[model samples]
Target: MKRTLVIGDIHGGFKALQQVFERANVTENDQLIFLGDYVDGWSESSQIIQFLIELSEKQECIFIKGNHDAFAEDWFSSRETPGVWLYNGGKKTVESYADYSPENLKLHLEFFQRMKNYYVDEENRLFIHAGYSSMHGPEREVYSSNYRWDRTLWETAVAMDKKLSRNSNLYPKRLLLYKEIFIGHTPTLHLGVKIPIMKANIWNLDTGAAFTGALSIMDVNTKEFWQSDPLPSLYPAERGRNK
Candidate 1:
C-alpha cells in the first residue's frame, strides 16, 4: 500500500540508508520525506547526496534541511569551511566530494538549495528536521534556524509526555499546531534508544546515524518502522569523524 514514509537523519551512512529503504520496500508510490542531515557522519556523505538526487529524480521526495545541511550549503556557495562545520563531521563530507567535477558540485548545491525548512502534508502532519515553537499559525514562524536547530520544543514535548495530567487543559498548546509532528535533529539514541521515540504525538526519528545508532524510516500513518543494522557495524573500519 502507498504511504507517506518519513526517514530520520542519514548523516552519510549510505549502507544504512539502502538497508532501511529496502526494508521498508520504498518505491515511487511512496511519498518519501527525508528529515535531513544527509551529510557529515559516515564516510559516504557525497555518495548519499548523489543517491538522494537520484532518488528524487524518480520518487516524490520531500527533503527538510537539517542544521548540518545548512552548514553544507554554506560550503557549497562559498567553498569556505567554517571551523565549526569542519569539527562537526563536516571534514568527512568535504573529503567525500574532494574530486567531483565543478558541474556535479553545482548540481549538489542545487539539491541542497532547494530543500525546504518544513513540510505540512495533507494530513496536517508536520515534518521538520527540528521542532517548531511557533504559536502564530499553521504556516509557522520557525522559518529561521529553529527549523533545523531547535531542541527546546522537543524537550518540552518530552516534558509533556512525562507529565500525567495531559488533559485538554494540561496538554501543551504548542504541540496542538499539528495533527502530529515528526522531527530528526535530536537523536533518540541520546534518550537510550536506537529507534524512533514517540511522545505526545511528536515522533523523533533520528537514531544517531552521526554517532553509533542506525538510520530509521517510519510510516507516519501507521507508526511502523524499519531500521538499518547498527550503523557502526556498517563501516567497521572507520569512525567517520563523528561529533
Candidate 2:
C-alpha cells in the first residue's frame, strides 16, 4: 500500500538524509512531506537542495518552508546575510553555493520560493515547518511569520494536561483545528529526547540533526519511524550548529 511519510528538519546533513531515506526504503509509491530546514548546519546544503529538486521530479513531495529556509531565501534574493543567521549555520549554506553559477543559484532560489508555509492534507492532517497561533487555523492566521516561526502551538500542546478531553472547555482551540498537526522547527532534543515526539495531537519530528541528533522520517499513519545515525557520526569534522 502507498504510505505517507513526514520528514523532519534536515539542517544540511545530506548524508543523514540519504541514510534515513535508505533505511526507510522509500519508494515512488510513498508520498513525502518535508518539514523544511533543508539548508543550514552541515557542509552539503547546496547538494541537499539539488537532491530534493531531483527527488521531487520522480516522487510526490510537499515542501514546507522553515524559518531557516526563509532566512536563506532572503540571502539568496538580496545577497545580504544576517549575522545571526550566519552564527546559526547560514555560513555553511553560503559556502556550499560558492561554486554555483548565477543561473544555478537562481534555480535554487526558485526552489525556495516554491515552498509552502503550511500544507493540510485531504485527511485534515496539517504539515507545517513550525507552528501557527490562530485558534481558527493557519489559513486564518494574521501574522504570516507565525507559520514558520511560532512555537506557541507546540508549546500549548506539550504543556496541555493529557487528561483533558477534547470536549473540555479548557482544551486549547488551536489543537482542535486539525485532526493531527505535524511540525519540525523545535527539535525533540530540547525536551531531552532523540526521537519524534507526540504530545496531544501534535507530532514534533525534528530530532536535532543540526546538533548531535539524527534525521528522522515517520509514517504518518502508523507512526513507525526511521532515523539516520547521529549527524556528528556522519560528519565528524563538522560542528554543524553545535557552536
Candidate 3:
C-alpha cells in the first residue's frame, strides 16, 4: 500500500533533506505532508525550495506555511530589508537566492504563496506547522496565524500526557479535534535530543535540522520514521540554531 509521509522542518540544509529522502525512500505515489519552516538556517534554503517544487509536481505533496516562511513572504511582498528574520537564520535563505534570475524568483515566490496554513486528511488527522486553537471547531475563532505561531497546543498535549491518570477518562478538548495531529516549528532538541516527540495524539516533528540535529520524516499512519545523519556531519562548516 502507498504511504503518507509527514516530514519535519527542513530549515534549509539541503544536504540533510537529501539524506532523509534517501533514507525514507519516498516515492511519487506517497502522500508527503511537510510540516514547514522550509527556509532559514543552513545555506541551501533556495535549493531546498526548488527541490520541493519539483517533487510536488510528481507526488502528492502538501506544503504547510511556517513562521519563517511568513517572514520570507513579507520580505518579498514589501521588498523590505531584513530585521528579525536575518538574525534567525533567514539570512542564509536570502543569501541563497541572491543570484537567482527573475523567473526563478517568481517560481519560488509562487510556491510560498500557494502554501496552506493547515491540512486535514480524510481520516481527520490535522497537520499544521505549529499550534492551533480548540476553542472554535474550524468556524469563527480559528486564526491562520495559530497554525504557524502557537505552541500551546503541543505544549498542552505534552503536559496532558504527564498528567493523565487511570481514573481520568476525559482528554483535552484540543486533542478531540482529530484522531492525530502532527506539527513542526518547535524542535525536539530542546529536550536534549534530536528526534520526533509524541505526546498523547500529537506529534512534534521539528528535529532542528537547521541546528545540530537531523532531518526527520515519518509514516503518519504507521509511525515508521527515518532521519538523516546529524546535520553537522552533512554541513561540517555551518553553525546551526543553538550551536
Candidate 4:
C-alpha cells in the first residue's frame, strides 16, 4: 500500500530535508504532504524551492502555506522588507536568491501563490501549517490569517485534561471536527520534546529544524517517523534561527 507522509516545517534546511527523506526510504509511490515554512532560516532557501519544484514533477505532493511562506511571498511581489520578517530569518532567504534570474524568481513566487492554507483529506484528517480558530472548520474561518498564524488549536490540545473524555460536555468542539489534525509552525522543542508530539487528536510535526532540532517526517497511517540530524550539526558554520 502507498504511504501518506506528513512532513514538518523545513525552514530552508535543505540538507536536513534530504537526509530525512533518505532515512525514511521515501518512494515516488508515496504521497508527500509538506506542512510548509519551506524557506527563511538556513542558507539554502532558494535551493529548497527549486528542488521541490522539480520533485513535484516526479510524484504527488501537497503544499500547505505557513506564515513565513506568506511573508516571503509578499516580499517577492512587493520587494518591501518587513523588519519583523528579517529578524526572524527572512534575511537569509533574501540572500539565498541572490543568484536567481528573474524567470526563476517568478516561478518560485508562483509556487508560493499556489500553496493551500489548509487541506482536509477523505478520512476527515486536516493538514495545516499552523492552527485554525473556526469551530466549523477552516473553510468557515473568518480570519484567513488564523490558518497560518493561530496557535490556540494546539495550545488547547496541549492543555486539555487527559482524563477528560472526548464525549464530555466540556470537551472542545473544535477537536471533534476531524479524526486527526496534523500541523507544523509550533516547534515541539518548545515543550522540551525533540520528536513529533501527539496531544489529544492533534499531531505536531515541527521538530524545530529552523533551530537546534531535527527535520522530521511521519507516515500518517502507521505513525512511523524518521528524522535527520539536528539542523545545527548539519550546518556547522551557520547559526540558523537559533540566534
Question: What are the per-residue Cα lDDT tens digits for candidate 4 across 26-78?
Answer: 99999999998999899999999999999999999999999999999999999
Report the number of clashing residue pairs per model.
0, 0, 0, 0
Q: What is the lDDT of residue 44 in candidate 4?
A: 97
**What TM-score number comes out for model 2?**
0.99
**Global lDDT of each model?**
0.87, 0.95, 0.84, 0.95
Residue 198 error, candidate 3, Å? 0.7
**What's the residue-level lDDT of 180 in candidate 2?**
97
For residues 1-243, write the lDDT of model 1, one tens digit per residue.
Answer: 789999999888999999998999988999999999999978899999998899898979999999999999999999999998888889889999999999999999999999998898888888988876677633556458788888877898787646555467767777877788899999897789878998887899998888888899999888899999988899998785453
| Candidate 2: count of backbone clashes, pairs at least 3 residues apart or interchain | 0
What's the CA error at residue 70 for candidate 1, in Å? 0.5
TM-score of 4: 0.99
**TM-score of every prediction relative to native:** 0.95, 0.99, 0.94, 0.99
Candidate with better lDDT, 2 vs 3:
2
Q: Which candidate do you rate higher for TM-score, 1 or 3?
A: 1
Which sections of candidate 2 miss by over 4 Å?
Answer: none
lDDT of 4 at 65: 95
Residues 109-136, model 3: lDDT tens digits: 8899999988888999988899777555
**In candidate 4, which residue ranges exceed 4 Å CA deviation?**
none
Highest lDDT among the candidates is held by which one? Answer: 2
Model 2 lDDT vs. the true structure? Answer: 0.95
